[model samples]
Target: MPVADDIKSSWADEVELEGGALPPSTEVRENGFKIVTDYKYNEDEKKLKIVRTYKIEKRTVSKSIALRKTWKKFGESATDKPGPNPATTIASEDVYMQYVTSKEEDNKPEDESSIDKLKSLGDKSVVRCRTCGQEHWTTKCPWKDTVLIGGKLPDDKKGPAVTTGFTNAETGKPGGSKYVPPNMRDGAAKRTDSTNMARRDDTTAIRVSNLSESTTENDLEDLVKPFGPIQKLYLAKDKTTGACKGFAYIHFKFRNDAAKAIQALNGHGYDHLILNVDWSKPPTHSNQ
Candidate 1:
């Protein structure tokens, strides 16, 4: 490998220079890196442009994640060129923000009169009583003393009279200032008679016995509903286990409907047990 003197001189004169100007110098620090941003404002167009430049040190990543990063874009991103697409990606704009401190009065306790005003406003709302059908609470109704039968008051009485068991020692008359139990009050017997009369008038109730433990009110309803319109259905269940207690009461709108249900389901087999259907008797109370 012998070279001529002219070739050696030409090679020594040829210096290797960079293609473009060197990039701007970056100040590297151990605590934190610096962010350099270039801002340009165009007065004619009323526009402000910003270009942020930052450096990030390369770190080791999992091989799977690196392979995923090298995968080709698919679906909606398949036609998109490299880097952020101007049509899809938007540059963030500066937003003005403010913080407000609450006033001392806002944290203070409300005035007593304000609370009373709220109570008065609430009272102004219509509140019809369920007992008397008046503009008052059911508990404060004037006719609350009267027994409610079928969501209605008895047509025969205005209200029950509350008696004070005060007796004159010589006259033997009931005019004492002592308190008397409601059951011992005067006219108590009349109230009981009215209640019993109401119950006796309902002759469409039927009793169903030998029901399965897993039976529910829905099951009984489904069984007897086809016979007629059901007014009420009561299934007796154990309080502890919440299971059927082998009996139930169903009140139909008409006696004929109840009779039909009894005829159909009396000997019917349900849950591997025979059903016993019969007319329900009004409950009786013993003096004891």
Candidate 2:
């Protein structure tokens, strides 16, 4: 038989050649290695451009997390394949919020019961002014400068009504809606002028002079406390240094006790100074 030149070749007749094909654009390497796939150079800009892709190696994860990943998805995600669905899972945008008072609600009429409840709650928390017994701080009381006798206001200065939100135990009626002074409260006793004047009397008070600068109120109290129950004791001291100003006033509950203290303590040696004890004289005002 003669050789046919136009016959097609089969795969069995083809022979393998060494180093025949060129390598791919991306170099093959182990996982976690960075591979450069494309690069370009710009001559006018004097810059080189290169693109790279990294294959991160598989990391060991906790058993709980790995198990959770294997849990079958449900709800809208039941038909979703493994991995997050771009349609259902998207990046969250930042949200901003602000506080704004509603003007429409300000004009709304409040229920009477709600108003009473609020007033009751406020009575528990609101400060009771000592000066006027009003629902305000003592410093903000309108009658702060007014004189009070036994912590009660005078009859003429009393307010029209009481708004303490307290119900009368016997009558079972709501207290009126006006501020009431503490003195005018139910069961409050009346104070007379004679009692107030008796408390202010200085007849039983004695003065001690020539005291040491280091004498304290306690030291002076100890010196004359044996005489009688001391009503009030005041030790005059320097405002800047806090040292005794060499004089003190001690008031006794009885004039006889004060007289005994004066007779015994006068010219007595104490704290390296002679104690000059005498009855405290009332201040004399020059006729203006």
What lDDT score belongs to each candidate, Candidate 1 first? 0.67, 0.67
Candidate 1: list runs displaced more than 4 Å: 1-186, 286-288
> What TM-score would candidate 2 get against the native?
0.34
lDDT of 2 by residue, 119-186 (tens): 67866555567655666667755545333323354545333332233333224222432444445443
Report the Cα lDDT for residue 44, model 2: 60
Please give, for residues 70-168, the per-residue lDDT of candidate 1 as tens digits.
Answer: 788889889975445556887789887887777666654554445456557876445667654656666766544533223234435433332223232
* TM-score against truth, every candidate: 0.37, 0.34
Best by lDDT: 2
List runs of model 2 lying over 4 Å from the truth: 1-200, 286-288
Candidate 2, position 13, lDDT: 53
